[model samples]
Every structure is written in C-alpha cells, then in structure tokens.
Target: MASASPLIDRHGRTISYLRISVTDRCDLRCRYCMAEQMTFLPRERLLSLEEIALIAERFIARGTSKIRLSGGEPLVRRDIIDLARRLGRHLGDGGLDELTMTTNGVRLGEHAEALADAGMRRVNVSLDSRDPEVFRHITRHGQIETVLGGIAAAKAAGLAVKINMVALKGLNAHEIADMLAWCADEALDLTLIETMPMGSVDEDRADRFLPLTHILDDLLGRFDLRRDAHRSGGPARYWRLAGTDTRLGLISPLTANFCDGCNRVRLTTEGRLYLCLGHDDQVDLKAAIRDGGLPAVDAAIDAALAIKPRRHDFRIAEGSAPAVARHMSVTGG
Candidate 1:
C-alpha cells in the first residue's frame, strides 16, 4: 500500500480492481436490466482491443492489480479470446494478480476452455432462477439449460465457478432456499445480490426491491449459517454453510452500502470511467486516450480519482428515484 499512488481516491480507497466492458450488446433482455426494444451501441463506438490492453497496462503500472472483463455479455464481443490473451499479459509477474469475467453464460459453454487457456482465472455466471419457465420469463427469453450447461463447461475447464443471483422480493424470493440448496448440490458458491436502484426500473422498484438482509434472516432462521472469517477481495461478505464447502454471499448495495471499503472502478465499452456504480458521474477516458495517449490516461485517472464521491448518492427514497437512463449491461454489471 503505497501512499503516493494516484489510484487512491479522496476517501482513502485504493482503486486496485478495474472492470472493462467489452460490449454493450446482450442476447437476452432482462426486465430490470434493459427495456424492450432498447437500442444497442454502434460497433464503431467501442474502444479497440489494443486500446483496452494499453489502458489496462497503464492501470497496472499504477498499482492496479486485478482486472475483470465484463459486458452486456462478454462472449458476444468479436475476438474476445484474443482480447483475453492480450490482457492476460498484464497479470501476475509483478502485474495484475487476477483476470476474471462476469458473464451471462450464454456463450460460455463453447468458449470456456479457450478463455482458460487465454489466462482467465475464474468466472461469475449470472443465473437468477433455476426454474426453466421462470428463467425465461425473467430474462425475456433466455434458456436456463444454456446457462446451466455453460456453468458446467466452465467448471470442467478448471476455472473457479461462482453463481450470482439477483435476489428480487416478489419475483424469486420464494426460490431462495431452492437456489441455496442447488448451489450446494452443485458445489458452487452462491452470491445473493440485492437489487440496486439503477436505470429506469424505479417505477416498480420499491415493490420489487428485496434486501439481502431479509434473505439472510430467512436462511439464519432455517439453517445454521455462520460467517466465514476469511478475506474475500470482492464486495460480497460470505457465510459458510455448516458442514459443507458451499457458502452464501450477500451483496447489499441499497439497504447496506459497501462504498466505505470500495476498491474498484468501472470502464464502459465506450470508455466512460465510472468511479461508483450507482452514480452518473463519469470521466471520458476515450477522449483522453484518443487525444494524448498514456499521458492523457494518467492525467484523467488522477482527476477522476480526486473527485470520486465518498459514497454513491443514489436517488431513491420509496416514492421516486430519478431515471438513471442507463442499465447494468452498458455499465458492465
């Protein structure tokens, strides 16, 4: 922990983890994620793969150690494996300590082995429900079997697999126990994330927003769940299932905020730098890089770090929340 690094924000949070979104395109349109007939980003607007690696290398040089590739679905990006191979060069030999991705798992089954061979360490697959019909309904038309098969493929490829479920109140609350049980049976770590007030989902948000605290309360009442004292670099705080290796993780962005300990930043496919996930504040790094190269990147990073909000000032208070007008897909989940 060097005190002189520019990645340290005003709040004393060191930005070590950088999430790079490869594309804003997705196969399935989830209700909470995007609206029907949502417009996609133009292909040319995205930063080139070479630019992605160059920007990441600059971050690594400045003490950023972990990089996670993300997207509306990363696999949909053309030549993503090539990008993985290029970014992998920034890891582990006094470089990035880990390289990972958060995918919808739509295309993971076919590309898992190649991704591993290209140096991805692990993957977090988004699977909201295990029920086929419910899964299709939630994702607008996604195949549960496809995601399941992809998870299996990732596991077989020797990549550490973790399943992420966006826990909603009236929607999937009843299936919480089923999700936990299934993860245990599959020997996969399960992380239950509370719905955040991002994008235009505010109209039905309050009614649908389920806090992770409530889910934990139910699990604690029904089973012997205890917190694991081990350190996990990510936001989720884990609780191990008694007598088994399967653990439950809770990410409460609304009811409980983790910003005080935040250690990451996000880079959108078009190169907008989001210092916090819930805010609209962004630094146009694409312009910086296009204009002045690495020196511009260094200056932009320092400027963004200086004004990084101490905590996300999300607009939500039961009645109305301003339309974020952006979805997690474009924001890289």
Candidate 2:
C-alpha cells in the first residue's frame, strides 16, 4: 500500500487531531447540550464498530497523530472498550501519538481501568459544578457522588484527569472558584469553556452564555494568574496559577476567537466528517468507505478539507436560532 497523504485544509492548517463521536446517545440531559427529550438515531444507522475502527485507521495512516473517542456519552456505547483496545494498537512509534476520550463520568468508574489499559494516558471529564444541588440541576439526573467516585477510580487507575467545565451565566458561574480549587486539590487540570450556541434547547442560549472574561477578572483578584504557553492540542488558553501545580485553561471562543490555530475536525457517529463544529459542512466518510474503500474515504476527507470554513459563525442572541441545528453531543464535545 502507498503511504497516505497528510490532511491539510484549504486555509493551510494541517489537521492532525480527529474527534470521532462513537454514539449520539447520552445518558444526561445537560441543559446546554440537549433537551429533556431527545430523538436519537437508530442503532442500525450508526457506523458499525468495525467501520469506526477502519475509518480511524485511515486517519492514523494519513498522519493524524491524536484521536479522541467522544460521544453523546462514549462510555454508554456497547463494547466500547473493545473498540478502544482496537484503536490503541495504533499508538506506537510511527502511528497515533495519543488515543484519548471525553466522557461525562457517569460510567467512568466502571471503565477507568480498562481505558488505562487500552493505552489512554489521559482523559477529560465534563464536570460543571462541585455542589451537589447545582450538579444535579445542571445534568438533570446526574448524581455528584457517582461522578466523584468515577474521578477517584480514574485517578487510582493511573489516568491523568482533566475537568471540562462549561461556563454558564445564571447556572453554575458562581462555582468556578470552587471547581478550580477542587481541581487543584485533586491534582487535576480545569478548563473553562464558554457556552456555545450549537443546538436548540429548552432555554435561550444567550441567557446562559457567560463570557470567560468576567470569570477571569474575578479570578485575578483571588489568585495570581500568569500566562502559560502550554498547548493541549485544543483551543484552551492556559494560565498558570500562582504557587500551585494547577493550571487554569480558558476556551473563550465567544470573547476571544482562536480560529487561526484550528487544527481539529469532528466525525459524527454515522460517519459525517464535519470540518468545523460551529458550521455544518460535512462529508460522508461512511458512504465513501463502503462504496469505494479506503481510497474513497481519503478522497472524501480531502474534499471535506477543501471546503473547510475559515471560521465558525457562532453568535448568541435572544430569539436567535442555534448556529447549527446539531447538538454539541452530536458533534462530539
């Protein structure tokens, strides 16, 4: 077989990171992510595990170094560990540099050991609030004890954990300081993300869009924050906390656009290759692979890159439609 080509978008950005959503079904209904009632795709329509592995291998062969398995909740996918282990085979010398995952932590405790054994050095857990009531309110049915237990299990399994908190104005914004302090105490990194206008939820997204700038201003008074030049392969900007090992990462896509350095693309559960999260331009890699094999999959990827938008059109306003109709979970948050 001939060597695969590097994936470079039309704007000259080398795409080395691929986030694949293994499933579109999540257990929690985070207010910002989904509605109380969601209509998920039929399991038969989802790309088979074999198909997912094949597509992932194609990307790895084509110079993609990092692959993050994501989902509505990746842990909920059946036999997901087998798939993780299958993908883990590509994590050596000339293959993928990292195989990681992003989970809501509802099922992390049960799978942490297996995930670690599958060659994942680190994992990102989405935890917005440290308070039980706030956490339950945000996740709807999530129990803080379960998530906390999962985090502990992950730590005991020797996996480096990072907390991903979505900043919401009226909801858990007040808990940012507490979350950061807890992360520090637990030796975990915390990244704050501005609420994104993705899909339609019960409430207006503008009501919950909390600018990281406000949080930063409040934090500066409480903690000594110095700029840190650490790039974690995503859009988060890092700031080293004064005298602690904890680092606070801020992903301010609304207040501060980080599009110029964009090197990532998303693949939905059914094999749609989404070039940008904030936009809906996608290519069907599932069809490509099924109809014409890996070569066709490569062609489809190249075509998708050619049309990759320069920057996402993300805006939050009262009565304004979501930038895209798909939920963040659909695109693999």
Candidate 3:
C-alpha cells in the first residue's frame, strides 16, 4: 500500500489532527467562555453537516488521520447524529485512527449510544466542578446531575471517557483532589485545565487563573504521582496516580505553550480555520468554497497551514482581538 503523504507545515511539523466545530451553538453560558447573556449566531450562519463533511474529506485526503467533532454544544444541533454518521462514513471503519467529540455533556445521555454506534471512539466531557451549586455558579446553568448522567451513559456505551476540569482559583481549585479520586474509581481519565484569557472572564479575574503546577504540588503531598509514558496526540500531559493505574492529565495552556508540536488545527463552525487558539489569524475556507473551486479551497488551507505560528505568546503578550469576534460558543470550544 502506498504511504499517505505527510501534511507538514512550514516548521516541518506533521499535521494529522483536525477539530471541526459542528455548530457554534452551546446551551450553557460558562463564565469563562461567554458573558451572562450574549447573542448567538443566527441559524443561517452556521455550517451545514454536508459542508463540514466535505472539508473533512479534503483534510483526510491530505493525511489527516484524527478528527474530533466539537461545538458550542454539539448535541444541541438537531441532526447531530446524522452529522456523526456522515463523518464516520467518510473516515470509514478504521480509516481514520481516531474519531472523537468534546461536549459539555448536557445532551450526552440521550445521544451517547447513537454517537458511539456512529463510530465515535472516545469522548471528552467537560465537568469543572463536581459540586452541583458550584457547577451552576460557574456555568450559570445548574445542570450538574444531567451532565454526570451523560458521563455515565457515555461510559456504559463503551466509549473511552475523559473528564475535563477547568480549575479556577477560589472556585474549583479545591476540588482537584476529589475530582481525581472520583475519576480513579470510575476508571476515567481526568484532565485539569488552566483557564485561558479568551472569554468573557475579565482579564483581572483571569488573575485568579489556577496554574496546573500548583495543583501538582498539592497532589504530590497527598498521592504518589508519576509521569506516564508520553502519547503522540492530544494536548494534555499525562501522569498516573502513583499506586494505581488511574491516569491524570494536565493542560496548562496559559503557562505552557505546546505549539512546537501542535499537531492540530481548528475550523470554526462558519468555515474559518484558526491556526492557534490565542491568536486571531484565520483563513476563510467557506467563502472560498462558495466563490472559488476546490483548488482555491486547498490553497486557502495551505496558506493557513503555512502561516501557523511557531507558538502562542500568552505570557509576555496580551490576547489579540479575534478576526471574527464570535465567542467560543459560536467558534466551537
């Protein structure tokens, strides 16, 4: 069999992962992602399932082997199941080594089985605080029980589940130990993420941003933790609780910039491709698709890939205003 051509960027890094936002519509107004009340994109502005799949096909043909479906809230999209089935068909049975989705878990209970059957191999569910009231306070929506039930349903559906917890100082930072303990018992992968400066969360409030290093220090005194064998894909760095097989992951996006090996690219629901999360540089593939031919579309993609920044400068520098000011919900988190 002929080897698939490598999709290397200007820096010579192989790009194999693609994150496609199915819709920029999400149910929860998480304090970190959006304001208490904000306008969402009109229905007509979002990309259709067919358009998303067509882009995926083009990327797959260019050696992308992994694809993850994300959304402001993916499950909220009426025909999400159909979208998943279509993406699965394009990826084929094992054509793409990995296919997954990241969700807030609001609608997973009803959609888990269908998603798994449609060839989604694993899922990453966001659960920042296990405390119901705290969860509500952070997300502005008190749906903790529903999210937990969704996690249970996803696990029961035989999907590899990873719990994503965004630790905020004075908020859910104290729950890290407890979160890890629960994940250990449930046999789930726990990822602790530091807050980013992009959302409605004020820059001053971002000072309360909890770094993963502090969490590690706190855990070291409580449990024996050891760095685990490194994995190729995904952003988090994995480590195991010393005595058990249960593993924990850390995403210190604020402090640690993993841009040198950024094997992934993000496509907004509306057809814009962003090279980095912290910067506003994006390519408008949707307009190209409508106005230009396939060559034009591919050229836009290549241009985006060529200009992919060496790394996101979030430390010494401030965040840039996005070329498209659509919030995380519209851009697909």
On TM-score, the candidate that comes out on top is 2
**TM-score of each predicted structure versus truth:** 0.95, 0.98, 0.92
Each candidate structure's count of clashing pairs: 0, 0, 1
Report the poorest 10 consecutive residues by lDDT, candidate 3: 316-325
Off by over 4 Å in 2: none
Candidate achieving higher TM-score, 1 or 2: 2
Give candidates' CA RMSD values in order.
2.3, 0.9, 2.7
What tens digits encode model 2's per-residue C-alpha lDDT throughout 1-333? 245778899999999999999999999999999999999999888999899999998888888899999999999999999999999988886888999999999999999999999999999999999789999999998999999999999999999999999999889988899888888889999999999988889999888999999999999898888999998899999998877888899998889999999999998998899999898899999899899998899899989989999998788888899999999888998
What lDDT is reached at residue 3 by model 2? 56
Ranking by TM-score: 2, 1, 3
Candidate 1 lDDT, tens digit per residue, 1-333?
Answer: 112354889888888889998898899887767776778888889999888888888888888888889989999988999989987876667877889999999999999999899888789999899889989988989999999999999999998888899987677889988888888888888899877767764246777778778789999988788999654567888899897788888888877778888998999999999888877778988999999988888889899998888787554556676346678888887
Off by over 4 Å in 1: 1-6, 201-203, 315-319
Which prediction has more favorable lDDT, 1 or 3?
1
Best by lDDT: 2
Candidate 3 per-residue lDDT, tens place, 176-275, comes to 9999999888888888888766655433444457878889989988877899986738788889986665789888877777778789888988889988
